[model samples]
Target: MSDFSRLRHCMVDAIARRGVKNARVLEAMRVVPRERFVSEAMAEFAYQDAPLPINEDQTISQPYIVAAMIEAAEVKATDIVLEVGAGSGYAAAVISRIAERVYSIERHETLARAAIKRLEDLEYGNAKIIIGDGTRGLSEHAPFDAIIVAAGAPVIPEALKEQLAIGGRLVIPVGDDQRQRLCKVIRRDATSYEMIELEAVMFVPLIGEHGWAEDGSRAASNHKVGASKKQSLPAMIAEAAENLPDFEDPGFGALFDRFADRRVILLGEASHGTAEFYRARAAITRHLVTRHGFTIIAVEADWPDAAAIDRFIRHRPSDQQQEPPFQRFPSWMWRNVEIRALTEWLHKHNSRIEEMEGRAGFYGLDIYNMSGSIGAVLDYLDRVDPEAARIARERYGCLTPWQKNPATYGRAALSRGYAECEKAVIEQCQMLLRQKLNYAGKDSDAFLDAVQNARLIASAERYYRIMYYGGSESWNLRDTHMFETLQHLLEAKGSHAKAIVWAHNSHIGDARFTDMGAARDELNIGQYCRQSFGDDAALIGFGTHSGTVAAADDWDGDMQVMRVNPSRSDSYERLFHDCGKVRFLLDLSPGKREPLRRLLSRPRLERFIGVIYRPQTELQSHYIQAILADQFDAYVWFDETQAVTPLGPEHHRGMPETYPFGE
Candidate 1:
């Protein structure tokens, strides 16, 4: 096979691996000569899956996205298809291979002429290019079997919908100019239609009667902006954001050498479920562990869930009957493929070392799993002292009633007759501390585990009770617990302990620089670490412009791999996207015009996606005000990313049926 043919097959194979299972769609992509549409200089990149810049500032869609759209449209050999905004004619060429005929429309006459010539030269007589407004869609050909739009439109054009044949599929990107989702609309009947949102996509504005204006007056898409958004900022950021090699590349670890000496390195993710964020954090963490001697790996997870992982990683024997890690809702956060790889690597690394203290330990810093912690404490005490176990069981019995739904206890406490159980949980924790010296000598690990569980129960009790009151009290208490937990973990490892934290950007970015602290007085672990560790803490945040994310529509809901709307035009993620590199690491540490400080002086809206994502109210739910220059020491950028591969429920071994209180 020729070079282009080999590259085309490779691209087809990659798209197939990413879940595009349609054999005809894969074959259509494989047979198309993508290199022929672009100029000779750009031919080398023609077969790459990434979108490539084409004529008139337009971008040819990524090969994977094109394949995905075609597969979603479900085109057939005898079908007649319509393609809007055929910039390079590549997608139309691929479609022509599978469909009987293809009619492509383009608003730009120059692009239309070029596409016509390319199609004719390649003997793709089945495809025809027309110079006209694509939004009007070619009414001459009354109805099309499948219509695919390249650019993002403000809304589904009525004319295009009217032109779809009965049972025809129309795939278009619909949303504001800054963010859009690829939606497949099917004409069910004369007036009925079915719309299914596929994934998030970013494309140049579809400029016509039904789309954005010519001057960008209708652009920006209701974005939140700062004082001055000089166009130079994005370019300056792109220049300063250092390019990074693939995560597994040796050079990728060297990029983090500047932060190797910090006592605490907090790696953050814009959303809980992007694969790149987890993989990137893992790479830097491995570098810190192997090259810099960082021994503690703490995360935003429950103590009991992570304890199971800790034992597995540190080569400590555990009861065969013990529950597996991450059994609750949103279990995919820690039970994903990327995390599984990290744990496997850590376990191997720890096994190579003989001293237990010298090996890196994985731990959770969040306050959840009160019932699990109670069970673990009782189990620990039972093995050491049966008397203490009985007393602990009695003390924790007060909380057994609310084990299924601890939030109800908070409401119960607010009522006139109910009493708070805070005192009982604390007294039990204090007793455990008092006997620490006596029990620790027997097995330091066992005593520490039991004591931490006791401590967790006390904190969780107060957390649940105050959560009902709302405001920042509960938020502050949670962060305090996390910070205190980190301190205890570090202290247990000695003054030489160097820790790495994995959490959402909201929990790791310095809240002082954002409205979280300034407006609501909501303290987070990032702010606490900065106050405690001072210059010894390095906070790095990760963000993406457009991609897929694993999220749920509601709390405690089933996980769905949903589309992450592109960054709002006025958000920091947009600026990073404009930087033009597919991915990079931008140093935002304070200095004299260093780390692009001048370019980032103004405050901008930053996107923060947690476990739950409600796209309908994304601006209000996800965006926050923050001065990026001070919010983090560095920012890792990925122009586009995909959702994490979530493990099946089989991974979650055993858990109490009433293990509620999942925060």
Candidate 2:
């Protein structure tokens, strides 16, 4: 066979390995000629089991994902299929091999025209490409045996569903833009449809009248309130702010009562060093713990360092007393006056309650500490079981040479000169987990911490190693680790236990609605929590129109009180500022006002200031396009804000601004 033919067979085999059982789907993929559907520059990578950019910022679905969707649809030789968001006509071409006819819709006229020529050149006689909104399926080809939507939808379009023939299947990616689950809706009878969730997949947004608007401009226009009459935004904002309860008002607690049943509440900060964001989150958390029975306060801090604060808050004796937690770079993030006050309150609250039930615990959900986590695992094991500690020490000894600088290990591991430590770390973690019951009676919490640390050591090892081979994979790995930690925390705390998450907006906000998410293929804790807990997880984001923020121009630079530029005229912050409230919250729940929905659904610039802040390049580095209403269930806006105050003397001065250390 030719090279391209061999590659095609390999791609089909890979799809089959992913559990695509339909023989027809596999055969169709095998004969599709994927190279013909992608740009000439990308043809070399056509057989790779991943999405490739086509035209108009669109992507040809991964071969495996396409096979999975087709298999789920259960297309037959006599069937007619309707394919939506047909960028390159690749998926439709594959469907044509299995179905009698395929009607593909592309909103981009250029792409549709190109796809038609490509399909005709390839002689895919059964397939036809049309230029129009895919959400409104081609009505001329009325009842299709199957409908496959290549792009994600906020809600499954009624038009597409109506176009499905009785006993037909509709396979689509359903959910918000950040992430979606592959869903198959089978028309059981004329009046009923059976839905099954297949798996998670990410795709470009479907843009049309029934989907997301073509661009932020179009989105803004569609959702613009009272377009004919120009009303002052600041005046409207001021009026709205008048209705919000005071920060300390007991009545504000009622606003959160709706979320009392939720298992997780992820609170996001648009900028890490904003005082109002921290204070507001603390106030909300105090209420959740005191009245709503929240039992955990997890933040975006490294595990070993945050463990010190956890010990202090739980009133457990610890070696961390001599030094506070958060000694890492950007120490001011958690070692600030605002966080100190919150921790002090947690200590007092936990002290007043019994050890078992009512006392809430503090934990860290980040995995940046490679050596610290390993040391923690070994230290815990030594106290619980010396022999097990000896075994762990021996297993981890393979990594001791590079413990002082884990990146050295990351580099060395990639070369043949160094031995692979992954197996050793995995074995150590597995042994710890397997022996959990043996050490449970001695100290359950300690044992749990040790096991979690062991797991962290294993994950951190892989994370560091992957960071060396740069890509968004490292980002995804970190967030996945955080999500797993949250899950473990909930499982250990008990089924009814609720928690509050404190993380940067990038980590806590749903990534789908932002440009960063599309570029990196990143998924944050907010997206995962939403998918896992659905309505039982509430994501709240905090923002400020303009304020003084504590940040540095570069990593490891001295923290300075920086002036935050005012929000852009086209940004969400501007809208909030115009609302005229000094401080207020807006609920974006499904049943909220249509005006609010319209305002939020429109894409607008959202600021995201991290540890490193550079005002000169703020637009490129700190701003992202986001549909605020779709990104979060609610938003808390501080019209003006001040910087957070650091709690103690800075110790990170003169630290080398080197790789794997500053980030």
Candidate 3:
């Protein structure tokens, strides 16, 4: 078979695995000649699952995403479909095979003209391409059975909804320009519409009278203001402020009581090493465990390392044998004063609870410890069943040479120099799971840990292998593992068990409202929790306008006290700083305040600092456009903050080496 034909089959198979169950959609994908849609120079890459640049700086949508959006619209054989942002006419061709007729609108005249000829050449008789602003629905072709918009919009255009027939589905991305949620609006009646957010998507800005402006510079220019005429900070403070001096304040308990019934409470940090963010999370977590009966504290740390902290907190005998946790890169993240205080509090709290009644536990939700997990699985088996341990050792022996650096093994596996040990790892995990009931009668916790470790080995192997290949798939795998780990912990703890998740805002905030999701097709624990538990999950985000943060200039570099840059004039942090409140909580639940709600919906820059910080590229590296009110359920803002104090002796005492001030 030809290479393109083979690639076509592979693409269809991959989409099917991603949960596109429509046979008709699958068939259409198989039959479509994607090579015909692109220029001859790019024809070889047509079958790849990524968006390729086409005429007029536009791109063809990724194959899986196109199928997903089409499936979301639920087009029928007799229905007429309207597709906005029909770049290269590829998506319209796919839809035409599923629907009776497809009317596609493209904002770029050059792209529209090219797409028209390509569609005609490919004999897509039912598909029509027109040049116009896609944000304005084709009113001449009124009452479309399904309207699928391919660009991000500030809000769902009323004109598009008006064009949808009764009981019709309109699949569009709704949010700010940088990031948006794939929202499916079903016309329930003449005046009522039901909106369901599917996943996060990033697309070019839809420019028109009803959408963003044509030049794409309006958002920045409109929000920017001179110092004397800046929006009133005091007015916003007075309208929305709820003072939070400390986590122990009575107000915090009352605030937390509002989410007393939630199964998961995800706390987010704007930066990983902000002292206030860590303290705030610790305080809230203490209340959740002591008063609200939350049973687990799962963090963004790796599993094996966090298991050590978990043992220490639970006062398990295994703690004596385990090495200190958080010894890896970014060790200060969990091995700091803030986390130490929380772990001590957890130990004290667990002391008062009965073992069976369920003492609160600490766990990790990252997949960076492939070799450590493998060792952990073997260690557990040796203690319980030496015979089984021997078998596991032999099975995992193939990976022994690369134990110090598992990524080397991943590279070897991907290059086909060494075979993948996926089957062996799976079999080991299955063996542990199959004997769960037998082991539960003796040492249930040990058995559970061993099974989880075995599973982590399998997942981490796949994760590292994919990471080497370079794409967004590895990120999805890691987050999926974390979400699954959270689920398992919840199940093991009991149905009533609640969890407090600690992670960066990027991972804890709903990705649909953040640029990370739009650009990388990433999903985090927060999105998974929201999807699974709905309103039963509460996500709280923390931010500061300017602060001292503990971070390294490069990965694995020495930790230092880094100066955080001030929020941009048009950023969300500046808005909060303008409020003139030193520290306050803003509730962002639906139906809170109409004026504040409207203000928060407008896109503004938000800061995100990971373990590594480079001041020179701060704007490009750290800032993302987001609608504040949509990103979190409640936001805790500290106008000025300080760096977290590290626990070890390697901490640096001077200002960061590359401070930008006076440069």
- Highest TM-score, which number? 3
Q: Which regions of candidate 2 deviate over 4 angstroms?
A: 1-247, 252-254, 320-323, 415-417, 649-663
Ranking by TM-score: 3, 2, 1
For all predicted structures, in order, the TM-scores are 0.64, 0.66, 0.69
TM-score quality measure for candidate 2: 0.66
Residue 554 displacement in candidate 3 (angstroms): 2.1
Ranking by lDDT: 1, 3, 2
In model 3, the clashing pairs are 233-578, 233-579
- lDDT tens digits by residue: candidate 1, 1-663: 997897888778767777899999998888889998887767876776556656676767778788988999899999999999999899999999999999999988888899999999989999999888888888989699999998888888888999999999999988763346899999999999999998866567788766666643333243323222444677878767789999999789889999888999999999999999999999999998999999999999988888878887887866455566687878889888898788879888998999999999988898888888988899988888899889988888889998767877888887655778887889889988999889999988767778888888899989989886555678889989999999999988899999999999899989877767654457898999999899999999999999899999998999999988888887889988887899898887777345257446445678999999978667656876677877889889999999999876554346333222122
**Model 1, poorest ten-residue lDDT window?**
654-663
lDDT assessment of candidate 3: 0.81
The reply for model 3, stretches above 4 Å from the true place, is 1-234, 248-250, 649-663
Off by over 4 Å in 1: 1-231, 649-663
lDDT of 1 at 196: 98
Of the pair 1 and 3, which is ahead by lDDT? 1
RMSD of each: 18.5, 8.6, 9.2
